[model samples]
Structure formats: C-alpha cells, structure tokens
Target: MKKIAIFENQYHQVKIQFEVANKIFFNDMLEYHQFNSSQDYTPISNISEFNLVIIDISLSSNSDKDGFDLIEEILIQNNPPKILILTGNSNIKENLKKRNLPDLPILMKPIDPIDIKDNLSKLLV
Candidate 1:
C-alpha cells in the first residue's frame, strides 16, 4: 500500500481532491492523509511512506505556509515524494522560482478531474 498525504487549507477543496484520488486508485492500495489549514506539514518524518504529496498554494494565513514552503520542507528529506502542486494562483511557478524550488509540475485551479488523473498517472505509475 502507498500513502498519499494532502495539505490543503480549504475543507471543500480537500474533500474534492480526496474523491478524485479515491477514484484513481483502489481504497486498499492507497491510504490518504489529510491536513487541515492550521496544521503544519512537518510532522511526518519519513518521506518514503508517502508516494505522492499534493499541496495547496494558499494555506492558513496565505502569508506564511504556502505550497512552496511545504515543497521546500519536503525536499530536505531523502527521496522526497513526487509532488503535485494544486494552486488557485496562476503565477505559482514564479512564486516557487522566487523560493528557488525545482521546476515542479503545478496544476492550476479550479483543477480539472481528468488533468489531475492524467498527471497523477504519469507520476505515480
């Protein structure tokens, strides 16, 4: 079984993404962990435990704790999971570049279900 952790501030958006992930994989094969707005993304010690990580661009205050922060944090670990950046902002790549993160595949909001599936399939497979 593969673990997939998702960090999203909005409850409704997280709910929708979970449904999409569930549709893509069998329930037994994939375990999903969800973090709400207030929580930090640093708890999980072993990055290997999660095969994929989907992070929302605006988390909590939106001033701090954005998706780029989570990505930077994860990159410190040995073998970081494949990241799927879901952002409402169109300039997410620019924001990430400002933070000096690697060129990551970012999915813009409102995310298309097919695009999500297609991207995840490419990464996870």
Candidate 2:
C-alpha cells in the first residue's frame, strides 16, 4: 500500500477530484492526504508511509511559498515519494526554462477527473 498527499488551495477542487479518483482506482492500495497551503505542510514523521505528493502551484494565501519554492523545500526535507506539480499557470514551463530548472510535468486546472486518475495511476505504477 502507498500514500498520496495533495497540496492545493484553489477551492479544494483538485484535491477532491484526486481523492475520489484515487479511491476509485487504487482502492486499498493508496491512501490520500490533502493540504491547502505550503506553510501548513509539516513533513510526515514517517516519510516511508507516503509514496507520492501532488503540489499545486497556486496554494492559498496562508502558504509561505508558491509551488516552485515549495518544490525546492520539499526536496530539501525528504527524498522519497515522487513529487508532481499541478498548476493552472501555463507560463510556468517558460519560467522554469528561463531559470534552467528541470522540466516538470504539470496538470492544468479544470482537468477532467479521469485524466487525473490516469496520470496518478501511471506514476504509482
């Protein structure tokens, strides 16, 4: 069994969608956690418990950092559980290119629920 954590504050739509999708597809094999802000994100004491983390580039106002900064902070904190960035901003790729950061895959907002399930399934597998 694996665990998943989703960080998104935009009305919690993406979080809810992923929760439902994962529940339907992964069943008992995957557990889900949701966070609305990066500042509120506390590293799991047992990092081994979770295997994947989905981060939204647009967290709520309470978050101390945006998606890009959160990605760096997350990497600094732990080594396991691959990270996925979900953002509505299309310019993010261009911005990252300008900074020479790794090209990361992002899930655009208003995405179909089925696509979310499929993407996660591929990652988990």
Q: What TM-score would every model get versus the actual structure?
A: 0.81, 0.81
- What are the per-model numbers of colliding residue pairs? 0, 0
Instruction: lDDT for model 2, please.
Output: 0.72
After best superposition, candidate 2 residue 78: deviation in angstroms? 4.4
lDDT value, residue 97 of candidate 2: 79
Q: How well does candidate 2 match the true structure in TM-score terms?
A: 0.81
Query: Which 10 successive residues of model 1 have the least lDDT summed?
Result: 36-45
The C-alpha lDDT values of all candidates are 0.72, 0.72
Question: Tens digits of per-residue lDDT for model 2 on 1-125?
Answer: 77777787864565567667657776746677777887565654444456788888877778888777777666655455677778778798897677566676677877766877777777887
Cα lDDT of model 1 by residue, 1-125, tens digit: 66777777675754666576567654446677777642444564576678998888777784356667667878888888998887788887788788898888877777765766677767777
lDDT of 1: 0.72
lDDT of 1 at 91: 85
Runs off by more than 4 Å, candidate 1: 24-28, 37-42, 62-64
